[model samples]
Target chain A: MIGMTLILKKINQLIVGLIFLYGIYIITHGHLTPGGCFAVGAVIAGAFFLLVLAYGSDILKLRKREEGSSVAESTGIFIFLVLAFTALIIVTRIFFTNYLPKGITGELISSGVIPLYNIAVGIEVAAALFNTFLALYL
Target chain B: MELLLSIILGLMILGAIYALFARDLMSALISCGIVGYGLVICFLLLQAPDLAIVQIVVETITLLIMIAVVLDSSREELKEKKAAEVKLSHFRKWYVMNVILIIVCLVVLLYFFKEVTSTLDPLGKHLTRMSTAYIEYAAEKTGSANLVTGVLFDFRGYDTLGEATILFTAVIGVLTILRVKGKK
Candidate 1:
């Protein structure tokens, strides 16, 4: 795993950023597109996996970041639950209710709490998967 | 599109058979990956892009996990091979029985498939009420343009919540099992 080759390493470095960006794009556009939180999260985790393969586990700072990923995973789920509960409390008084105004279709900010939920789930999935990889690698 | 789907499905069946009979663990894992990707292609051809996206990602992660397990237990696997070979001879009768059972099952399934297809309307004239309702009202009810997302996150939010909880529990279980003693 210690840098497949100089050219491969360089290419991986260049493409990792784009991969992450694409993952984020998919997550954010979940309400409007075919891709959703889980798909985007996996894509982001793929980027991390690629990073690990290119640079080796030691250089990825996996040891130090392992705790961070665990915390992020928990926090993401916590945020999702809180959002669901808030919807219960403030909006429809029913759990998981989509209460916000359904803005015009095809807009970025149209889906009320769906986008937020997607982002939360995306974070949870990405962190959980990356953490699992780190655990297995260790 | 139908031809492409049939090809992919045939390849998936081939991959599954190869994985089942592969002598080495690594090749079996690789063949499993091939089957998983073929399923993803089949999903895409069925016009389920969301399923395809999710399946492809899951397949990749599964491959990585299998590779890690294989690497970790390489020596153990090698050690077990001799014992496995000894047991294989003893299990030959059962293997043959299982193969015959599988062929019988496949033939029965093919017969049922033909029966069902011949009875069904070719034009899909009979849509289920729930699906028709969803198609008609999903955008209006959830305000999401993507009907699948709207249904998953809005109409079926409880189900999604349950799915999330299940995933969380699985991760927690994995972490608990793999946790090193005396290490935080």
Candidate 2:
């Protein structure tokens, strides 16, 4: 059982949602924004870690969380590799070519394969970092 | 901008000087982080946002790991040191001698640095062939307005893939090693 008090809980509750939204925004807008997959992953991981720290401890719950993160991390990386190889298979036999038509730049739905990579990487990073923290902290 | 750069450089220098005088290893480590963060600011001001972001992340992560290690390994070291410090009166003479020695070493290092820097190329003038290509064609080729993101996910995607794989591998390793209940 690890937690602080009412103030931390209240603040975390208010902030965690905003953090998740911001993380998603950063990931989705990675092509035009200052942040990319690495930043988004770290931000998302930080949000979840804050949420976990505020809640009272349960070893079983933490175990389940860790397991879930592991699965998510594996899936994220698998998607990344699969996407990369898909370009290789169907297109000009290039490993990381932009097979999908690159839409108008600076738009929400532009940047051919980058947004997908950003999403996949964000999942992997957020999961991996959160899992690392749980493993070490517990 | 020059004023800001000088101010940050001065801050970094002060942090280094403070580290020399810090009584505890933790404080010294934190002062060292101050220098790294100063460089982060420098990177941002120099239009190198990619370098700045990477430096900030690496600095923070490394600082966390190091603090954890220091907390774990430094408990008994103080006990041994207190045992060695029997007479404060005797220690004061040696402390002055150490200060003189440190000052001498810093002066020598600064002189060497001054000479070395004089021979280097000017700032922002030197651009490598790869970076030139990125600056020109990254947005067009990758369709990413953010040049850093363009280079990261498009040009050097293999590097990003390797980095993600390495992070995944490290997490898996940590989980395996830190399992609470496992088969014998």
Candidate 3:
């Protein structure tokens, strides 16, 4: 399908970068902010959606990138599982234990493995949702 | 705030009714979106910023997915089916029965809700034992400033893991169903 008009395309091009940046900020700061992995992941997917709407699916170079996103989705969940199991293997030997140091609260790097989990979830969700979008369009 | 909430909820219900009755599938989807955003607003009013943020994004994604599905289908065929083959009186009977059943269900639900909430502590003062512990100790235990995130990813990590697995399964199912095979 063809995309929108030139003015719409210009607007989408200008705003998509900002959207991605905001989504990244939300995902990274999930431990300290109201937003979390699922929310920010949807936001990032939304950026992709806008791009697809404004420039058509061809703009994504889907043939090359589809497999990449699928891999990323699997890798994200794998990383998340690894992180969870590492805690189980290490300190407490219990599943989903927080074995890492709980640094000072409110710091960027304070939340030990929580931030990492958030990042993993964010990647998984963003990739999965984008892949779903691509599948529907293709 | 209560008045505003009531107004928003009333509008949401109106939108839902509109969606139910809308002949055009696209307009019905739009009405569904309106109701979704109205719920987002309700979440914000309830002081759940996290829920509000998540709801809005989820709503957007859902709307996009629905739009894609609708676009992929033949709209002309859907439009042509608008002319009902069944008589109006036949539908009126079913519609009245449905309305009566809904009213009965609503009354039963309202009674059960009243009974359940009456047994619990008053609204503003109520906090279950586990939640109180979480609020008091989640910061010290998890070192996450956001208690919701701490509870979701750390304290209740297994639940989150299960959720992730569910999403993964859904994606796999979608990919499997939609995979395009090359002819040999």
Candidate 4:
């Protein structure tokens, strides 16, 4: 039984790593492809769901979902607001203006605010979906 | 053309009937989802991807909540309260009222669809002519092939802020609803 548990833990770790990489890929390639923050988050949440399904609610007990989810939800909102307000107060001198420099098109590191926004949304969605699943499972 | 419209109309009517008569609440909810999917198709056909996406997201969230609520509610067994018996004439009147309301709503929707399609925006023409150049110029200026992203996040950043706030409001509402005291 102990050996089987160890094997399951190793498999779970591998699955989690693969899912994380896929999430980043989707977020980065969001500009060029049909996939974006929401799709990627949904995918990542799906992986988490699979893990929970395999390991049961006992495994997710380690995460303490309510606290983690609230923090994620609040922080995502803060990040979104701060980005918008900073752009407004500084660059265009107008509230919520896109003051960030448009760097270059089609580059992986391009689209300054776009990528940042995507990241924020990706975090928000992943957290929200996970929270929903946790809430339901619990 | 007529055949397509007839088939669509028939499907919609059948869906409504199913939604109305489904024995289980979950089945009714799924029928409601079907109705929403139908609306999404209509939105896409009307050339409004933004609206369609928004509608789809909202429907997904609503369906999730509905399923959760149904699950929670079904877990409880409530005592059956005595029911007030209705007269035949009263039942007939109530049924008539509901059918009239449904017919009125359908007619209103049909009229709205006709009006909107008749005044369709020349967006497809505009997109074909200018979208590539717009993307190029926007990318050069704003540094984003994700022209939509550039427009959403930078050019019209305020709109994105509005969207963020809307999401934030939803989050707050969810927390408020879900937060239970002494639960840990």
Highest TM-score, which number? 3
lDDT per residue as tens, model 2, B5-31: 999999999999998777788998899
Which residue runs of candidate 4 sit more than 4 Å off their true CA positions?
A: A1-22, A38-43, A62-66, A85-101, A132-137, B1-13, B36-91, B94-139, B182-184
Candidate 3, position A6, lDDT: 96
| TM-score of every candidate relative to the true structure | 0.85, 0.80, 0.89, 0.66
Say which prediction, candidate 1 or candidate 2, comes out ahead on lDDT.
1
Answer with 3 or 4, whichever has the higher DockQ: 3
In candidate 1, which residue pairs get closer than 3 Å at backbone N, Cα or C atoms, i.e. clash? none
Each candidate's DockQ: 0.71, 0.63, 0.81, 0.38
Query: Which whole-number lDDT from 0 to 100 does residue B53 have in model 1?
Result: 95
Q: How good is the docking of model 4, by CAPRI class?
A: acceptable
lDDT of 4 at A65: 34
Q: Name the lDDT value of residue B176 in candidate 3.
A: 78
Give the TM-score of chain A, superposed on the true chain A, for all candidates in the order listed: 0.90, 0.91, 0.92, 0.81
Task: Please state the error at residue B55 of candidate 1 in Å.
Answer: 1.8
TM-score of the first chain of model 2? 0.91
DockQ of 1: 0.71
Question: 1 or 4: which has the higher lDDT?
Answer: 1
Pairs with steric clashes in candidate 2: none
Q: Write the per-residue lDDT of candidate 1 for residues B1-184, one digit (tens) a residue.
A: 7788788888988999998887788998999998999988888777889999999988988898788678767723345777898898878859988899999999999999999989887643655798889999888888899888888888888888887888788888888877654244
